[model samples]
Target: MLSVQPVSEAGFAAMAEEWRMCLEASDANPLFMSWPWLYSWWETWSQVLGMELVLLGVFDQRGELVGIGPFCRRVLVTPGGVRVARLYMIGNAWRLAPTVRTEYCAIIARRGSEQAVTAALVPALEQLKWDEMISTDVPVDQLESLKVGRFYDQRGYRMIHRTEDVGIRINTTGRFDDWLAGLGKNTRLKAYNRRSYLKKQGELDFLDHEEGRDGDFFGRLNAFHMNRWGKPAFDREALRFHRLLLQRLHLCEGEPAMSLILYNEHCVSVLYDVVVRGCRYNLQAGYEEDFDPKVSLGYLHLGHAIEAAFSDGATSAYDLLAGNGKNQFYKSHFHGEAVHFSTFQVVRSPLLKALYRIQAASPLFMARGLSRRVGL
Candidate 1:
C-alpha cells in the first residue's frame, strides 16, 4: 500500500534528487513538472501571492518516494464569480502576471506508479480541506497516459473546466536540412531567404545564454517584449525565479537555452526556452516593435532557434507552447502538430459545482455576476 505525507518546504528541498529521479522515470517528463520549475515558482511567485503550500509525498510500502503532488491553497474566482478556496497544482494557479502558465501538468509520479499515485491521491486528498482541486494546462492524452484527470472522473470527481487547443508541436526528426526541405515555398523563403537578407543589414548577430551573456540577454528580451506588446513578459521577481531556474536546470535537466537576435546595436528579437526530456519548449519571446513586417525579424530569429533544437542530439521536439505570439500572427503559419491542453477541476462543494455548471451555460459577462454573494 502507498502512504501519503505532507512535505514542508525544507523536506521538499531535500527531495531534490528523488524528485529528479521520479521525473526521469515518469511517462511525462515535461519541464513544467520538474522540481526546479515548480519549486522556483513556489519559492518566488507563489510565495508572493501568499499562497499556502500543500506538498504531498507518496511513498510505497518500503517507504520509497514514488510521487509528489505539489499543491497550494489560494482563493480563486471562477468565470462565474464563484469564489472558492482552490487547491491548485503549484505551478497551475490563476495566471497572475509576472507568472507563467504551466502545461503538461500532472502528479510527478514514477513510470509504472502513475496509476498507484493517482489512486493513492484520492484518499489522501479527500482527507484535506478544500472546495476544489485544479490541475490546469493538462494535455488531453494525459488522462489515459498518466491516469490523471480521467482517473478522478472515474472515481466520481472531475470536470473539464477549460480547454486550450492552441499550442504548436514541431516534429524535429532527421537533420536540419531535411526538416527545412519539407517546408512550403513561402515558409522556405521566410526561414532561409529572409534570414539571409536580415544578415546583410549590417552587423546582424545572434547571441545566446551559453556565451555567459544571459545578463544582457534577459534585459533585451524584456525590452523587446515591452516594445512589441506594450508590457513586459516577466517582472523583477519572476525574472529572478527564472534565473534561479536556469541555474537549477544547468545542474539538473539538460542544457536550457536563451537566444537574442541583435541588429547592429538594437536587439530585434529574443526567446527564452527550456530544453528537457528531449523537448524544447519556447516559454516566452519578443521582437522589434518598428522593424519591417516583411523582414519578419522574429520569424528569422525563431528559425535560428528551431535549427538549434534540431541540431541538439538531446532534443526531439520544439513546442511553441501555444498562442500566435511572434508578432500578431506568427504561430499560425508554422507547420507542426497541434497539442491541446485543458484545465480540469474537481469541485467538492455542491454549491460551487452547481454555480460553475450554471456559469458554463451563461453568457461571458453573466459569469462575472453569478454567485458573487455565495460564501465558501
Candidate 2:
C-alpha cells in the first residue's frame, strides 16, 4: 500500500539523513523540499505573500518514502465576499519533475516502484480539496507518460502551456578550437575577431564565487547585470531572495557547478547557470550593454563558457529554460534542442478563475508578455 502525509518539522528531522542522501544523488533533486532552507523560504514567503504551505510526502508499502510535493496555498477573495484557499507551487520543486529547477518541484521514484508511486499520487491529488493550483514551469515530457490528467482537467482546472528557449551551447569533439570549428566559418571568424578586439580593450576575466570571497563576486555580478540592462530585469524581491539563496547555497555541492561572472577591465557581465546531472541549466544571463555590440562580448563569453562546460563533462546545455520564438533565434545558432515544459492554472473559484482569464487576456498581457525585443 502507498500512503501520503504532510511533513512536519519534527517528522522532517527524523527523515533528514534519508532526505539529504536522496537529494545528493541528483543535481536536479529539489533542494527546496528539504528542511531549514525549504522551510525558511516557505515561511518567509508565506508570511509576506499570505500563502499556506504544506510539505507532503509519499511512502510505499514498506513505508520507504518515495515522493515529495511542496504545495503552497493562496486565498483569493471572490466577488461574492467568498474567500477560497488555493494550493499551488512552482513545478519542478521537490525534485519530482526531472528537468529544470523551481520551487515545490515534484519528486518521483525514478527507478524502483516508479509506476506504483505515481499511481498512488494521481488519485490522491484528484481527491485533494484545494481551491486552485498553479504548477508553473513543469517539465511536460516527464508528466506526459505519467498521465497528469488523472488528477486535473479543463472542467475542474484549466491547463495552460507555453515554451521558451533556455540558452546556448557548443558540442565538443575536443577543446574550444574543435567546438568553434563546428560553427559556420563566418560565425567562427566573427567570434574569433571579436575576441581579438576585446583583448585590446583590457584583460577579460571570469570569476566564480569563492568561500569567504563571494562579496566581490556578487558585486561584479550585480554590476554586470545592471550594465547589461539599464533597469533591473527581475523584481527587487526576487533578486533579494536569490542573494540569500546564494549565501547559504551550493549548486550540487561537489560539482563544477558555481555562479560565474565575466568582465573586462572596464565592464562586467554575469552568467546565470546551474549544472545538474551533467547538464548545464543556462538560466538568465546579462552583459554590459554599453560595451560595443559589434565586439560581441556576450557571444565571446558564451563561447568560452560553453567550452568550459563541455570540458567539465556537461553533456548538454539548456537555453531560456524553454523554447520560444524570440529565444530561438540565438539558441538556433548554437544548435539548441527543444524541450517542452508546462504551465497550469487551476482556479476552483468561478469568480477568481474569471479574473484570471481576463488577466491573462488583457492588453497588460501584451505589455507584460515574456518576450522582449532584446536579451533572450
Candidate 3:
C-alpha cells in the first residue's frame, strides 16, 4: 500500500526534479505535466481565479515519491445560480484569459506502481470536500491504468466515462530521411514543391526559436495567428504565459520548438510545438496567407518542423493534437493516425450529481430556448 500526502502550493513548486523523474518513469504527457508548463500556468491563472490548490504526493512503502496529482478546487456558479464545488486537474481550467489547451492530462505515477498510487489516491481525495471531480483531455491508455472514471466508486461517487476521437498524429521511425521517404509519393512531392515554390520568390530560411529571435518569433506568431483568425490567439496574459513557458523549457530542456518559415527575409509561418519524451505536440500554427494563394504555407512549414523534430531526436510522433468541435478538419489531410481523449466525471453526492447532469446538457437547453424565443 502507498501513502498519499497533501502538498501545499509553495512546496509543490520545489518538486520539479521529483516530478520529472516520476513523469519519465510513467507514461503521462510529459509536455503537459512538466513542471514548467503547469507551474507557469498556475503562476499565471491561479492568481486571477484564486483556486484552492493542493498537490497530492503518492509515496511508496519506502517513502519515495512515486506519484503527483496536480489538483485544485474551484466553485463555479451555473445559470440557475447554484454554486458547485468542482475538482479539476490543475491544467484544465477553461475559457480563461490564458486558456492553454492541456492535452493528455493524467495522474503522474511510477510505471510499476500505478495501481498502488490509485489505491492510495481515493482515500486522500475523499478526505477533501468537493462535490464532483473532472479531468479531461486524457489519452485512453493512461486512463485505463488510472481508472479515474471509477476511482472513487467505492466512496459512492457516480462515474461517467466519456471519449472523443479528437487527436491526430504521425509516427516516426528511427530516421528522419526514412520517415520522409515513407510518406506517400504525392505528399512528399507537394512538401518539396511548396518549399521550392517559395524559394523561387526569394531567400527561404527555416529558423528555430533561439536567443537571437525568441521575442521576434513569438511576436510574429501572435500577430500571424491573430491576423489569420481575426482575434488574438493568446491575448495579453496568454502571450505572457506562453513566452515564459517556452523560454523556461528552452533553458531547462533545450526544447525551443516554436519554429518559423521565412521567405526572402520575410516571416511567412510559425508552428508552435512542445516536444517531450520524444513526441512533438503541434499546439498551434499560423502562416501568411498572402505568401501565395497557390502555396500551402502550413503544409510547407510542417515539413520543416517535422524534420527538426526528427533531427532533435523527437521521433516518437508528431502529434497534430485534436480538432474537437471545430468545423474544419484540415488536420485530417495529414493522414496521421487518430488519437482519442477520454474524460472522467465523478460526482460524490446525489444532489451534486443532478447538477452535473444538468450542466452537461445546459448547452442544448440554452440553444433550444434561444431558438424558441427568436423563432429560429
Task: Give each model's clash number.
Answer: 1, 19, 0
Please tell me which model should have the higher TM-score, number 2 or number 3.
3
Among the numbered candidates, top TM-score falls to 1
What's the C-alpha lDDT at position 336 in model 3? 70
- Candidate 3, residues 161-252: lDDT per residue as tens digits? 65565788877645767766767766776565567766676888888766475466667776886777787667766877787787677433
Instruction: Return whichever of 1 and 3 wins on lDDT.
Output: 1
Root-mean-square deviation per candidate: 3.1, 6.6, 3.8
Could you arrange the candidates by TM-score from highest to lowest?
Answer: 1, 3, 2
Tens-digit lDDT track of model 1 for 1-376: 8999999888877777888877788766458888888888888776678688899989999988888887889876755466678788888655433376777877778878888887888677778888877777778767553334455665455464655657888877668888778777777787667866766767777787555544566777788778777777788877888888888885456566787777886667778887887888888877876787677666677788889888888778998886665447466566778888776667767776676678778897776566454432
lDDT of 2 by residue, 309-360 (tens): 6667545443334443323355556644454455555555566556556656
Model 2 lDDT, residue 181, Cα: 65
